[model samples]
Target chain A: MLIRRPAGVVFAAGLLVIAGGTAGLLLTRHSTPALRPPPAGVAALPVPTGPIVAPPQEQLDKPAPPVAKPVSLIIPLIGVQTKLVTLGLNADGTLQVPSTTAVAGWYTGSPRPGAIGPAIIVGHIDSVTGPGVFFRLSELRPGDHVYVRRADGTTVEFRVTAVQTYLKDKFPTEAVYGATPDAELRLITCGGVFDAATGHYLSNVVVYGTEVD
Target chain B: MRIVKFQLTRWRVTVLLAFLALLVGIPAVSSSAAAATTTGYVALGNLSQTPSPVDVYLYSSGNSSPQLVEPDVAYGTILPYTAVSPGSYSVKMRTAGSSASSTPVWSVNLTVKAGGSYIVVPLRTSAQAGSLQVIDNNLTTPSGKAFVRVIQADLNQQKVTFHCSCAKGTAGDIVTGAAPGTVSPQAAIPAGPWTMTATGPGGVGSLYVPLTAGQVHTEIVISGPDNSILIENVLDAAGAGVAPVGGVSTGFGGTASHGSGVPLPWLALIGAGILVTLASGLRLRRRRLTAKG
Candidate 1:
């Protein structure tokens, strides 16, 4: 004698069987196909004769030029000789500090000439522990000599004309770096009496120089 | 057939559930997307009188990359842009199609929020005269008197003439024919767009002042040991005074009179008296000698 099953149980059993079948079919269809060797005597397909787009003539004619490397600085008067890192303007419009405290050089803005218009070079008077490069920056007197070696193997010489000390707040920015018809050089470093309270130097020692030639 | 019906019913339920899930997720995605966008307008201030093309750049916080907006626009023109997820931003304004020599004219840090407006005020260039005082002693006499006249050589050329006369008396003494010593036009003198030249005993100097509509050219002459002449709005249409170029002289016409080509009555009278006394003495001496003979 066959026992009558509940309608829900019958429906559940039917749904499970259908789901299993569907899943199995989908899995089989999606399985990776086996690789087969090519038939003997099969010829390779011919490449289509389509229009070949030539790359831009200008780009092909002239290869991309390499970038120029920065120059190094050596000043015998102040006893500074080191590689200079480019510095930019800070958020507050003040100059940015060089990554390396040993030597810092300014990026020539449009108004300023490359190695002209009083291109400024700055370095630290002292590092965290002791005296660093440019420690004797204030001692630079008039008529001192400064040398800068360019990447192209040319060295530019300059003569110091004046050395001045100015309070940081009263820096003569325009007078020092403003428009100039001739090439000039300026070296700056922290100076004046050191203040224990503030780590920053109170004054800036500026050495003004003109090209030797 | 029963199994097919059960399967069809289960599939429909699953599809319905998926549709409901999509409906629920759509609102959340839309809200977040809306929150990420910011809309605002930028107001440029203090533009030049003439329209100049400027490039506007927007930068994200501490990001070196800048998005260029409004490649070019006339001066005083406002540009608006949309940004995503507003925070601190820097605006760099530069002269479009110009070299770095035309470095960015304006740079400022702004904190922008979702749906907020920002205003940037640029500093305008202004023309100013250095100083407004002159010094010329030859122009100022010991009597403290001087003479000044203004001559309009051209529609725009106004020449100032300063003269000091020692014959006028002490440094403070006023000359009879001289006016108050200041020369200014009742109305704006339309001088050609050239500099005004001022002449005095000391020398001649040029002044640059912008001339504008409904303006007047005026000359101000000062009389004293420290003599100065001031020209206001000489070139500036906005009414800025030209620096006073002057001269300072020592006191003129002192007690010891040097020959100034002026005939002194006292000197004449003293000479005449001396001549008369000598003549009378000679005549008396002759009469006494005849009586004795």
Candidate 2:
């Protein structure tokens, strides 16, 4: 048997739903900027008390070799071969994306490919019209070969190690940019659900690789 | 004719003695004041377990007398810094209480550049073999910034990670996998107070370094009780090309007035040793002649 609700009860329930939604919108607006500065309790402490017995200045250590710029990128498994462009840090300190959707970009701030640290490359998964470069980047598997041609006329090969997708707000900056004992590479692109209201993707897909002999 | 022959032999002996005297006197007469103007500093540390209380001496190639720079320096202890002429030096390590003429257990030669600073570390490879490690100081940093390079000096400890103590995002790792005697690349950071934590075998050790603007530093790894790892803060020079004008003198703990041509005691000792050895040789030769007659 179908039960009929009173008009007054139905109206009150609708009002309650609207109030709950308004509260959720307020919470989301307040917490959008997730990255916050450290609290006062965790502030940097003062230096120790005593004489500063530092060694005297002398000649600098031997200069490190200059890193070569990457000219092109090739991923055999995904049949991706495209010319590369240079990218730099944005005004907000975030990594800048390449202008074109078909080609990838190597971050200038990161160590170059084959250098003794992790180098970063970023591309777009899609554009306003259609699918863009690195659209199938998340499909890459372990042991896939990634080749990068350098301006110095040498090619560096890397093997994919891991693939992970993380929310944009939960990005691991240090792991991607930190120093390493050997040469490494990071391929990044946008992925996951796209919000029409915000006009942005919710997460990012990252592929980690290490240089092969 | 016999008198003539005897007089000729006497003249020959006099000539030989004179030549010996010249050889001994030349180094003694060389101006040591000029050498001090281009001098550098060297600090000696005894990190070896074989010779617990060791005495160290520094000598050049042509110099016969060795200057006792470290007198009975115990294991895991570093003697104060000493001013040395900028040149190649051979270091001789002997057991404590050994005589001045005793044979040294270990010896190694190293070169110090002019106006440069260095640390000489004597390490124990095993019960049988030991070696001396020389570390050049890198004191240059970006303007209004401070630089730090962490090193793993204790061979017993495997590896260590040096980073800010607060949290992950505060700053990245200053150094990673700092092996024994291996220096990390310099990380130029903001000039301020920093609490660094070192995580390694057994446990973690931390240190607080107050980095002044335009200064550089190195934090060396040390072994604490029960195989724990610790860090010892060592200040690097002010900068590579920038000399400290009125601050603490370069090298260990120098208080000598700059530009003053103060005579080093070691220079005098070398001169005395040379003269004594030459005089004794001449006396022995004369005695041999008397016995033969």
Candidate 3:
């Protein structure tokens, strides 16, 4: 007669084998999948619409100097080139635009060059009609370089340190403009996923740079 | 001969007298003709025998450019040696070498008399450690109101205290505005280099305060309290407070006696829950395997 294994041992062995098989199957099923390339021709898309409604007298006025002419801006790492404009307080005490029309410039009311204050520079990421200057501002990364040339022929260079976004209501005004000991630069533009419901941009993109040289 | 000599001597004496009278009369006439002018001086800061260098400038409504009396002078140093006419003047002070980089620490306006000496002391001092009391006089209803208090203590005892007081209703109101409970002296605290803590009726809201002298600074937050409580340094000029100053508000709509509670991040809690569940599942599987073996 053939030797017969105990029923308990046989059952235990059968269960162990089943458990191992199930664990293996699960491990295989839950493995991460490889990333696939985006579909072709996906880069092209319609421009985003923003909330600022044009006034009836929307005729473009003479373009103001991009930031005060005395200051020259250059970002070596990011390949950014622009001028500064002087900004002031809006009628409602909000940040004033350099010009009524779309343009880039430094806020005149802001701190002067080489002064220890928040030097602000604003640019249009995209015009209502299409992409304007600073269209690729969102692509800038930390360690990118920026240079500011003053009228006195002296140039001050800055390095990208941080980039952040905040809702219009939650912008830290004092922290951005209040007195600081070091020379800093702040570049502001609209950012975040565009929302169709609100005419206004969902968030503001602020790029902070510190004087490097 | 005697008569002639005596007459000549008398004439000489009369001429000398006339000359003296003319000299005295000319000064009297000129003094009466001109407008009266007075002189005054404005002394900046506490006048110390050995004054520290204090910048002094003269600002007058009459003049467009403020005259720099002493570009930088010691505490007791006098500036614009000339008397300042009657008018209002503002005295400003900054630590030496402070410019656009460093903001002025003290500024005060003084009304000076036409001919008087005005002594000004721009007290700029730091508070070490002391009890601060904030009394809210806005008691119109019976509901209680919550206020946030930030305390900066040495050795990292940064704490946020919450206090609540009931609104004193009018004697006429029989229902609402009853006397509320005694406000709590402190709020929930966490490990902190805690520079600031803001308390509201809903919970402790956003907070920001600068560290000073290696000590943490505290803030009182009132949620939705439109009116801000003015914290001033009584020892300094009128309306002067510490640097990097801030205020908090009590929230709107609640019974008013609410306090800003300690907030726990939802993401952290969710993560913890997930971790616990995963651990429990692993433990159960191991136990089952051991039991079977």
Candidate 4:
């Protein structure tokens, strides 16, 4: 042989690594993770008391930094990437959804991503044409990562904690829209059986996450 | 004789008119007293070495008569807000059951505003020798968060900054530059268990506080037993949760009825990729064993 035996073996090994990696990517690329049980909403902690004696010296968290507006969102788990549009309340007091299924939106009424409040992002499950930006939203399982790119060109990562499907008629307004004790993110879209008569879905799929980085 | 009778009749008419005027004046005085009073509120706290169980009196501007507002309030005690008519007044501290004529141990000129709430406390030394600190209590509960402001009443900690000590907490000072007798500006904070710390040149102190959504807290850094720095929590408002403004409306029904599920090519590609990986793994294992042999 023109090449040494060791070199030939090494070259084959490199090819195997590449092929195996590509295969692993392809296998997980349009797949969904197993759905987990819905997560309970944030809980209220017990009130703490002041010291009866002199308190000990200690350090505390620094002041929160100013955060810029978010521009886009990416969820590699279910293959979602899109520009974010600013959303506000409609005339009927309902939250505005994205105009087109190709994109998603962030609610202006809620705090921005990375702020110490529940940030809301909404998308469409499907359109008349085909799948929407969040078509595989239900496929998101716990431990999945969602990255949000901010106006300042920085990114904040969040980890999914739960994915829940709630009937539209009985939405938990406070739990879904209320304040949490920490910075959190909520991703919403349509789910459940589609109503042919009304041309809408009977339920909504919501994914809850907290800032991990 | 007729002239004399006419004079008598004129005198009687004058008396009748005077009686009618008196009847009208009585209701005018009564209505003014019965009308709605523009009122504010005030609470008392004894943080100084003031002897406990003291009586508090309010003397309105230009009025000498005193109104006994709070009585028998002990040291380290903060009285709840009491309704008071909005006006210029003076608050005086006296020994419990002390006669109104007795000299006051501590007094301050307090002007209140309608619909406003306030807390007044005597700081430093005995009540007879200390000054008063007026704290504004008119604060709204933050939406989906808690609101807090610290009162620097510690004997040694002159100026301090407070923040939460937690990895999951929001960063930065919750309240800064809080000095003795000065109420810091309101700060909106995350609702959670917080190990709050106060830091400054005078000294540092730690406190554990659990704040809930839609709450307003007043952190008073007072002198503890044996002159140790202590922190106290005074809950102003504790309404839970937040207001609901909007809900989600997402998606159209076009693809929902007849599901266009995952395409076959993608699945086929995934299967092929798995096979390729498995074959590669087997070949690598065989090659490694051959080398070892």
Candidate 5:
């Protein structure tokens, strides 16, 4: 049987999941004896508070560098290697979906890949024709690798941290789109049961990743 | 016994003294570390009629030295909040990509106060002259208290009143008939979810405003062809200020715009189930034949 909770309850549950994820990060850091302390200068910066989560070490070492446009994305685990296209807000202010089913769209309003904010990329689960590029996006597991090649000839690697499914009505818009202090990635696709009557998926599957290099 | 008791008392005194020293010295050390550089936060916004991008500079001195703070700020876009020190600053605005030696289109001098947070908007004056619109920000919310401030920046609207439909009851006329460039006083209300209603010369509209204890927020109602509410999560010591929360539409329209439909992938599931069942049936038949043979 399918159960539907209030939107507030769903949002709170998402937050709990995210909180558990960061707590696990802290635990892993503490358990690893080989982890080195931050450099003298980095140790001096004010401890990040609030929504601006401190980036992992690789990102902490670099200040706000020149933003590089992402040219391509490669997720080997899901056999996804597709070029990225820029997307903007629609007339109604919602994100514009990619026109082609086989292509993924990155939101232009957010920072580009390898930048100091959450760079959002979204794809359709399936079009009227067939399955889309991110059809198997939900198959991705934690620790799966995602590579984004930038126009500057550098590729930023991200490690998957969490994958969550939320009903479209209860989607945590702020958590998905809000600004972050460090470089992050959110890959989204429509998932859950498909309704023939509505012709739209009921939920969105969001894959959260942190830039490793 | 007497000697042991005396030694124990001495040890307890030493530990208490150490704890007292830490209690008093921690804040002193931290304050002294940051007291040398007094600072405040400031954000920039562009709300001019022109569509061209603007380059904003802050001159601590006269027009001699200019520090380009925000560059290529497109119309209707707001730059991030930054820290600044208390001083007399001359805000200069010019066409983006223009040479530093070129003349600025407009300039305004502001005496910034220490620890003050402000939103500086480059706007056209009543006479159509370029000017700066400074909105002072309040980041003080006592425990279990939240605040709401209204800004009427609708040029065409003659006046607007901000009403609140809060949990306990409705508070009407929180901001009564505020004009352009007018900022309503920050009103303290119980921290919770509020449906803020802004009725103006154009029409009436409402948006959800979630408030938490010890958090302050400012809502600016802008009117024109594209009317919207801009919510600023004012910076506090707790964390970095949230990026400008936009897309709060407030005009003559209902806010029920979300798409509706429950999806059921029963056909796919049924197909998969049938395939699995047929495969298992074939395997069972083959096993029975082998056993019988």
Candidate 6:
């Protein structure tokens, strides 16, 4: 018995595929929005005057030693240990990624990993075949450890402070690359769905770390 | 009869609209001007061991008179940031409700420059008494993160190492060799409840602080004669929990900002760091609370 509606069967199967894909996309997407503004009267103080003692800010020491360039990255938690290649802005002013996805790259514009300011490193999650260098980046948790070897034969260890993900359209630029008072490290990678049309990932995964000195 | 009841004519309506527009536009103009004026910030915290309250006096430089500003600040308490005009100022602490004529317990002078923020805490130990543990709280508050510093103002725990032995990346000595009346440098950590330990020579005291995103905070450490430590987390600046947009052109590699030959990402990141926080209702970055380098 032949029911001659092959086109109808093909259309129904397409619909099911789309329905399941949509459900999966919604289930896996990150939902947290950008930071919300705190309520009023919560930001700062009222009128001034306090106990007649000394000013506490004076206790800080701002001096720092000379910085050394980063040579390699070591994230033992994720089994990532690779030499770092310097990255710069493309002519279009976007940060350049490494030509290959197997090795990670460090953004040359940022300070070195052991420096006083923030140093940034980026990698890919995957390519057409197997897992990329930062495939396990999103699996890192707070209190994890990542190390960077410097040109001066010193290794600076960094502790994970936070792990966050953001939509590429709403990526947190300041949160990932802002100037800090102490030595810090930032790791970046692409995550979420791959857009066949755009040839890019839809989200960015960022990891923040502090020096363990 | 209907025409007699009608009040607003076209001409009259036009005049009323003009007046309302002027009223609305005036505030917009004035608020923009006010945002341009840069002022300094000063936050005060009480870290003494005594139960008696203390009064804080902030006298303008060169003035000898006692001008009471903050009164009855209890131990382990930190007040919000006080917006201050940029200038030299001398602050004094007195016993609560004590007369201005009475002898002051401690005094210190500090310069408040435009856009600077400072935290001042008093020490109660005889060795460091009358001294302040100040940590310059002028750091950028990126979205989704909090900036923090520790003030080792405890009297009994003279020298201590503050450790964050948590399961997360904060598991290490955040501050080392923090002598009494000293403060630690700023550290950026995730926003949440963080448990830390102050390990001194005699005992180990526990501290806990709850922090939110987009603000600067200070954890004041104090101890009684029994060596029991108390920690008070205080807000220094409300950067208003807002993140600065635009950096590194991460997703914009295909956008017009990239192809347009814009000197971006580098300039964009700097702009983001200098962004004035709009969380003004919380007395946030609206006061032009700039950090000193």
Candidate lDDT (C-alpha), each: 0.41, 0.59, 0.38, 0.64, 0.57, 0.60
lDDT of 4: 0.64
Candidate 5 chain B worst ten-residue window by lDDT: B248-257
Ranking by TM-score: 4, 6, 5, 2, 3, 1
- Write down the RMSD of all candidates, one decimal each: 47.4, 39.3, 37.9, 34.2, 24.0, 23.0
State which candidate, 1 or 3, has the greater lDDT: 1
lDDT of 6 by residue, A69-153 (tens): 8887877656677789988767655677767777888877666676545688988776655567787687788788787877766
Off by over 4 Å in 3: A1-69, A98-102, B1-293
> A1-213 in candidate 4: lDDT tens per residue?
412455445544544544454444344332333533322221121122221111111111222356789898887656677899998777766788889989999887666776654688999988887889898787888788788878877777787877777777766555556543335688999876566667777677888776763
lDDT of 1 by residue, B43-122 (tens): 33223222246666667778876754556655333332132355777776677765533557667777665434343434
**lDDT tens string, model 5, B1-293?**
34434653564454346434533432110111111113555666666645358888878756577755677876555454456668777777788988866787766777667556666776643335546777676654443455667766555566778877776554645788776666677786676677778787678767776565444455666544455443223222111122212221111111111222111132233333333433433343344446555
| For model 4 chain B, the run of ten residues with the poorest summed lDDT | B27-36
Q: Which candidate wins on lDDT?
A: 4
Better structure of 3 and 4 per TM-score = 4
- Against the true structure, what is each candidate's TM-score? 0.30, 0.38, 0.31, 0.41, 0.40, 0.41
Q: How accurate locally is residue A197 in candidate 5, as Cα lDDT from 0 to 100?
A: 53
DockQ computed for model 3 against the true two-chain complex using alpha carbons: 0.01
Candidate 3 chain B has its poorest 10 consecutive residues by lDDT at B232-241
| Candidate 2: clashing residue pairs, number | 5
Local accuracy of candidate 6 as per-residue lDDT tens digits, B201-250: 77877766555555566666776556677665555543323332332223
What would the per-residue lDDT of candidate 3 be over residues A1-213, giving only the tens digit for each residue? 101324334333433443443333333231112212212342232222222111111111111123224354554433345666665555545555444223456755444443333467776555444544454555666776666677755566666766765555556554444333234577776644333344344445667765553
Question: Residue by residue across B1-293, what tens digits does model 4's lDDT show?
Answer: 34434653564454345434433432111011111123566666666655556787778887898765677766666754456778887878887889877887778887888645677777763223457667676444556677777777665566677776644646657777766665677777877888778786756777887776665667777666765666777655333235334336687865664532223343344345444444544454455556555
Comparing candidate 2 with candidate 5, which one achieves the higher TM-score?
5
Q: What is the interface RMSD of each candidate, in Å?
A: 51.7, 37.2, 23.7, 18.2, 19.9, 19.4
Quote the positional error of residue A46 for candidate 6 in Å: 28
Interface RMSD of 1: 51.7
**Considering chain A alone, what is the TM-score of candidate 5?**
0.70
How would you class the docking of model 4? incorrect
